[model samples]
Target: MAGVWRQELSSLQAGTQNSILIGIIIHSGNPKIFEPTNPRYGFGGERAVWSFTFRDSPDDFINVTVWGSTEYINSCFKSFQVGSVVEIINSKVLSRRPDDSRDMFVPTVTSPLQITVNEGNALIQFHDSEGRAHYQPLLKMPTKTMDSLRSLNYVLQNIEELRDQFIDLLVVVTFIGEVRDIISRDGRSFKCRTFEVADASTEKTISLQLWDNEWIRLSELWEPRKTVLFLADARVGYDNFKKKTIVSIARKTLITENPSVQQALDMRLAIRNRPELSPSDPYSLPSPKNITNVMTVQQITQKLNAGSTGTDERVQFFAILYASITELNLDSKDANLLLTKCALCKRMVQKDRDSCMNLDCPSGNGSREPYNLVTFNVKLNLKDDTGYLVGCRLIGKAAEQIFGCTATEFQTMKAEQRMELKWKFLLSKFDVRMQVLGPTASITRAIYNILHMSRFETAEDISFDDIIDPMRNH
Candidate 1:
């Protein structure tokens, strides 16, 4: 626990992390010594602590007073050599002489009780700008196992087939197991361990379950002496009881080594600084109650501002990086991988993929090919102001078909041409946000879309073959 004087004395100190300092040393030649005590430091009138600081270094070097019981010092204990380090806890600097009328020029230490001697410097290690305490990112990763998890998200999130096949994308996995957790056909409880993953794209805690075969091979390369988790891929699904999904990873997800810290840092920076992102206020993270389908972007923006900017940095602090689960929805690797413009090559390519689709792309493999494309729909909406916010929904070629664009036309497009295509799609969404069509048409679609009640858009009154799902976003 911090002492009661911690806060008050800290205000007089130069920084937020440490307390005030004082010294007792004096220069050999210049007898004049003065250190004025600010009124806030407890001395209301003329009082000061005198000491000759080692000013030769140009970097801050203090001359603090040697503090101890009176029995510890001599009659002229006031004089001491510079650079003599000493410890003084729960002490304050003040004017040495209050009653003296003349020689108002000189100042000296009032009372200092040295706690210890031969003291070295002390550094404050905590970053408390937010309500929570934070440390520098320099701490070596706590685990020794090297797992490879790159930020392929900027490129991977744009994966059309992978996105369509999986309900959610899970990236970055870690676990404590050193051996495989194998479950055989005979229902034997052999261990074939799996890596656990959590991310923002879905609220689900996903994992990559290695089969006995992959686990065996992985065990060979994985040094059993120390525990290390390698990042890998997995297919996710709920268990028989449907409590939570376990990822079936042996099939598709690769088993790789651990990612380096530089990779993580780069991935984090990429996601944080992604172009066309909403700069959410770090102080204002929303609660579950605050999230609603009916909530406008403006309202969300307002709620975010009103949210707690944590004290001691426990709450909100880093603008792009919120430590919360939702804030960490996307993986760092995902951010680095998803922004890729080359759908075919999967290279760290340009920002505009449509340009590649149109021109003779070095990495192009035609638009209709399985790994050839990735597209997103930009939903533009107006809140209090006109068209102030945009939401992103990923889509595929089928969505373009719904928009009446042919494959040939979409493939041969320049950057502006593709943006124009997206812009047109957003314009249509703008009409929807504005409720462009009058009451009847709007009611017809809204009734069908929300309640799944209308016959015009759905086969509500007609066929039993109607998809029971609310909507297929892609």
Candidate 2:
């Protein structure tokens, strides 16, 4: 395995590698006899994928296999296209073909733990609408290519025009071969695996998944192995590659259009009016409906503790993490009695009073004053995005980032310090764009109402209804 790559041609398997390999990462102690791990990400195929037309293939075609872990893949999952070398471990799980002939060049392994992607070789170039070959300076990056894309620092430095945003208006591409197989969860659902897509540096074969509606409409655009101007929405897709994510266009979301000689004119107009565009639209702004108010620490804690009685359930959500489903593990009878005494911090609280008896709390026993008390539990489920379902305590000071002063400090402060901290927290939310990346799993009441309400959800809903009616009519 050591110093063996430069000497001879060889086949490899499960144990350590055998003959001298083609190339390896110099940083991993494997000498880089070939492509170095890039420093500027823009050089990778993603730039090409992003800069090119959604419907077109690169002028050339290259095929490859890749590897990596599920979590790592998911992190950059939205950025690469199929076949880009996004991983360093076997990521694709393959099924045997009916003919007993194994897939020759592409990366695939039924037993994922058994395969790994270390190096690759391919031929690819830029293509046009007629399926003819050509060369282009930039390429669109597929979701799969994200892993390696960040390494191409030199590419990005050179392309100052394509900074953080990925942009592509038009380009051409070709599929390498005949249709291989169809993949779908149910027989009615349809999807496909393509031969390969390529540009100058690399060519990648990828899988294209389609739902029933898309499959029926795909034929109008399936002029494979030929070049065509692709026009439409270009979003990232996931694939088997260890380092690259898959890039795809849906029949409805995006498309490949026929080209005419006027393509050059169209290209010029596009470049002149909007030279920076690639196959993608700019990152979009969220809908106004998504905007909402933030709640005070007292209100947030109260709602989280409100779930003990099912009849008074505070609210519902579109989705909760799989681990957050407390009902699944408990007997329905005991679960109903599962009063959430913890103050969103999972601390045992005293239901008869507003505070917890656990003087052991780092925050100290909460205020002796008659404050609100309620019961709720964490929604974290092992099936959620992180997969491990354990809810953590939500601290108010942490949510608002009260530098230097804790909630206890605020409660006992000499009015001015407490007032200053409150102003800072308020300003951070309204003026400084303080966004909580995560949904408040423990929250049930509208944050704004919490700062000024005696009654909780019941009253809040009525006000919300009133606010919504006029907007709906308008």
Candidate 3:
């Protein structure tokens, strides 16, 4: 006699009966058919069970099982797929429990509660008179404002406090490692991709798994140090192998790149303040010794424009400093600029931390006394009569040589005093010779590596006029 109860997926509980549910089908598994063994059990002759996942919010989802006659399931529900909006009437909720039977072939739903639909008692609607399936608009999905989003620090610290609950939460984290492909241990055809992600709130990193098609679509966009926001509703579980809290992506999970969030801005600043490279790293420029294979600024520009420059190509050239050092803000007073490295591995080691976890080193041991490395990562504008190169990163040995001191010494000088000195020293000079390496192929922007630097000898210096002229003799 009572009207049908309308409820959201999040409000549903075990033992609920005579309820009507409306949601978008986020996932649908293949139907499993069961045949009757005898006349006594052949009430419907043959029946089918279909598992479906529905969600009303980006972070909330419910697993449901639809049971009906084989013909009804095959003809009516076979066309249903992900993203289709459906309404179900007269469904009963049951507490989902881990099945101990090893005969189950598919992944069992582990939600605290699940909805079940039986023949004659349930009705399904997936289409309109136009014969087109209906879908819920993305704008209708529940979302939280930036201010309402929970901090990753709280989630990582209090994962145990919120485990096994049905509430949804959002975390802003950054991806910090490579995505690696994984195959099932059973040597079956199963495959997936896993990556390490972290947040500025803590140094701890977690493993994020992307299965099937999700991996194929998202893996290409993944890069180290990229910030991402994750909306999670599933239970937080501990990973025994990784020894960290593992966050699984469900049908309701939403991963996005929204850098406007305050948390993302803070993480980006922290990453930039601390350089990833060390002094002893091979990528860092070596001290300038011999200069050879010289080329003009015009020639270098032509090579880059023509896409003929190889990533490993090295060439020497002369250019005038176009911008003032002060304007570039190369002398920032941020303390994170001063970083320490492991003596053995040549990898970065936190100031307060004692050991290196780099798998490449034999002595992955942390040291109380880490070798301090000065970082000089800054862009300098260089120009000659023929062409100009902007945002050329002057780092390591080349930067030290030009700055006239190590990073430690430069840090001690007054910011104002140093700026004045650098201006006079650089402005007074015109013939600046530099050996630059080719830009990385992956990056679209023009960024060259400053391998070497020196002042040109007046006698050996070729005039810009001669360098720019096509017929000028060397």
Residue-by-residue lDDT tens digits, candidate 3, 105-167: 223333467777777778777634342233355323433445545445676677777564323
Query: What TM-score fits each model?
Result: 0.20, 0.21, 0.35
lDDT of 2 at 104: 26
Best by lDDT: 3
Taking the tens digit of each residue's C-alpha lDDT, what string does model 1 give over 60-120?
2222333222323221133333222222333334332345542122221122211112112
lDDT of 3 at 204: 52
Put the candidates in TM-score order, highest first: 3, 2, 1
Model 2 stretches with alpha carbons more than 4 Å out: 1-421, 425-474
What is the Cα-based lDDT of residue 216 in candidate 1?
41
| Model 2 poorest 10 in a row by lDDT | 23-32
Candidate 2 TM-score over all chains jointly: 0.21
Residue-wise C-alpha lDDT for candidate 2, range 1-474, written one tens digit per residue? 243332211223334332222211100100111232564532333211111111112222222233222333332223332222221222221333444433221222122122223222211122223312221211332212212232113322333443323222233333322222232212122333232222222222223333223222333344333443333333343334334444444322232233333542343343232211111111111111222333322323333345234343233211111112221211122232224233323355454555445564432355333222233221211221222223332223222232353444333456455445434322121211111222243643322111011112232223222222211211
Computed on alpha carbons, the lDDT of every model, listed in order, comes to 0.29, 0.27, 0.52
**How badly does each model clash, as a count of residue pairs?**
55, 87, 2
Clashing pairs in 3: 354-366, 355-366
Off by over 4 Å in 3: 1-21, 26-50, 53-63, 68-82, 89-114, 119-123, 129-150, 153-191, 195-205, 211-229, 234-236, 240-474
